[model samples]
Target: MRCKSLDFIFDYFQQIPTMELEEITFSGWTAIEEKNLHAGEKPKDEKVYTMYHGTFLKYVQHIITSGFQRSRDGMLGSGVYVSRNIDKAKCYPLNADKKEAVVLKLKVRVGKVKKIDIDNHPLQKSWHQNGYDSCWVPPNCGFTAIKSGREEDCVWDPARIVVVDVACCLDDKTRWDLRKQIRGMNNHGAKDGCSQCHQNTSNTGSHPIQSCWTCTKQICPFQKKHVCNK
Candidate 1:
């Protein structure tokens, strides 16, 4: 399918079975106060300037990538636009300015970055906070962390699309149309809100129901009602 936005990619990851996925982790720079006092450290032990170091970058990669490509399409090197793989989503610490060879080497040895810390790595922090994951590294999605025995293939090839997301504009559009339809039925007596047509989320809010309008076999509550209302 043609990917018009990034949500298509995130929805794909959300479909992934969590049992097959891992929670996100990362590594980068951090700031720490200096503490090199000759005889007396102020405050009984004054702390000095800080520096960024990495120590856990490899872990947070997947979770962060999924988040970045969640809502909208974003930029990468060469102004390339594409979808992300939720299962293998993660970010790397290379700038567009870095040499491709160096970036490739760094990505392959992601685990070696364990010593790096977030405070030192502002970009990494940006990735984490913004959910930047699922970026393409050279041949595929960034290489997977290598453990001894479980040879799971982490690298993703764009050429081999194993799955795709279906087009479902029905959800949002239905709510809008339903409002019109219900309004026509009410002729101004019935109040129009999702809560009235649907129930409270139980958590205490309402979401519009999903369904197709004309071109379908009976699919969802909205569709069934369309037929019954007729």
Candidate 2:
């Protein structure tokens, strides 16, 4: 992707450990046992239920890499994934804008945070490095959902009906062009086959699909585009 960029979270992937990834939802690995029932729920000796952790929430399988996808306006995508080399996750304090509305507690005025909008991951807008969309997520659409209370209900929509702005320079064509480029790189091995499967273990974990780090200036139809001060 291309654009004029100014500011970006520089220490890419610092908050995360880079490692090999795996598919946690494969059924052969998970087994149903009578003792596996939910709290206070009884288990029939012959009854079996698939395990929930490590993928496969209910019957639908889950992606285990690079995280989710998002639109420029904040709409999220269908799947939430993680990387192969992960053990745990870390959470931050809350932003004033997120304190009440968002469930993911975050720190104040820190990094460029955004909800991946995919699968309602908190800290979607995160301070840590790689806290954007997974390799599959876009740049302009940089909001993070932080929680998963009513995912099917929430959407990645521009907050309000937009009116054309006059000051911006990049037009629809450029924006579309940039987005297309970024998405196309999804399968391109970022560095060797290491990027073969970029995943996020935590739902709130970010999997930013980066464009040219140089293109920091993100233009939106809603506002006048300003030159990003690099």
Candidate 3:
């Protein structure tokens, strides 16, 4: 009877809903902006735009913790590059595998915007020097260097770009890794696996199509039998 009660309690706990990091909703971007930006620094137009930044999966946690850093140099001079269109953002960190890419949703304070349409625009790399807070490149602006044929933006200050959320594409490799982790935790004789399965006494545990990991038999074959001697 004690064992049955323990089993019931374990099952109940397992059924409880748990929230993961990815499942958490983000709505505090305004609070972040309010705390970081002063009234004198805010743009007169004060229009906040949604943008995205593409990077490697390895940098997601670091960016979230430490915030974004301005790039030393780029096509648009030294600034953090982003895009209003998500498709354009996803094409970033160029020449890398798409499976490892991640996109960060950002809230940008694009104050006093400037457009650099032509290849040799005088302010192409010095717009910030002339008091422009951000620069935009329109789609298909007849620039030979604009390979994506999409619009792009570069914000001069990293503080103006607030990360709102992280988006990751779960490709085959990511899925396989997740499955492996779940299996390691759910197998018999493992850390969180069935303690009743004595057959799988070593580190390795078996998982065969709803079968018992201990004796490799039918699912929960010994649940009513009270003991498994197989």
Which number leads on TM-score?
3
Return whichever of 1 and 3 wins on lDDT: 3
Give candidate 1 misplaced runs (Cα > 4 Å): 1-121, 131-133, 139-211, 220-230
Clashes of each: 35, 44, 0
Q: Write the per-residue lDDT of candidate 1 for residues 42-106, one digit (tens) a residue.
A: 11112221111111233223211121113232222111122122111122232322111111011
| Worst ten in a row by lDDT for model 2 | 102-111
On the 0 to 100 scale, the lDDT of residue 216 in model 3 is: 46
Taking all chains together, the TM-score of candidate 1 against the true structure is: 0.16
Q: Please report the candidate that would top lDDT against the real structure.
A: 3
Residues 1-230, candidate 2: write the lDDT tens digits. 64334224434446567788885431111232343333223222223222111221111111112222323333333222221111111111123221111111111111122333344455433312344322223222332442422211111211111111111112455434433433443334222222313211133233343332344443322121233344
The TM-scores of all predictions, comma-separated, are 0.16, 0.16, 0.55
**Global lDDT of each model?**
0.25, 0.26, 0.66
Cand. 1 Cα-lDDT: 0.25
lDDT at residue 102 of model 3 (Cα atoms): 75
